[model samples]
Target: MEKREVVVSITDNGPGISEDIQSRIFDPFFTTKPIGKGTGLGMSISYQIVTEVHNGSIQCISQPNQGTTFNIKLPQKYNRVIPQ
Candidate 1:
């Protein structure tokens, strides 16, 4: 499937996270963002949706003071029809 070709990335200009903290960024309810600004479950739930539901993987790239980027690899087509 062409969908197997991994792609997609998200970048942010905000302060980058430390390696220690980055490791846990995808943990349930984990977020570097301030309370109310984010729900803290975004990345965690995203990980599950990509890997478990879509059979894909996600990665983070960052350096202190250099901002952050999230790469998400997913299938182009889903087994279950998704509402547009």
Candidate 2:
């Protein structure tokens, strides 16, 4: 079967994430926010939903003071039976 891919990106103008913490952004329970401000599960859950549930991928690109961007890629075609 032929497969198609889709790419989606989100960009922001706020202060960018540091390189040191970029790798851990998708880790469960990881957060850079102050206590009570965040639970840090957002990215982690997003990662799982894309990569695990949809067989897709996610990435982040950023530089200090240059803002951040999130890139998500998903297959437009999947080898699974659809419910009718």
Find the candidate with the highest TM-score and give its number.
2
> What TM-score would every model get versus the actual structure?
0.72, 0.85
lDDT of 1 by residue, 7-41 (tens): 99899988897899888999987777787788778
| Model 1 vs truth, CA RMSD | 4.5
> Model 1: runs farther than 4 Å from truth?
1-3, 33-39, 76-84
Determine which window of 10 residues in candidate 2 has minimal summed lDDT.
75-84
lDDT of 1 at 36: 73
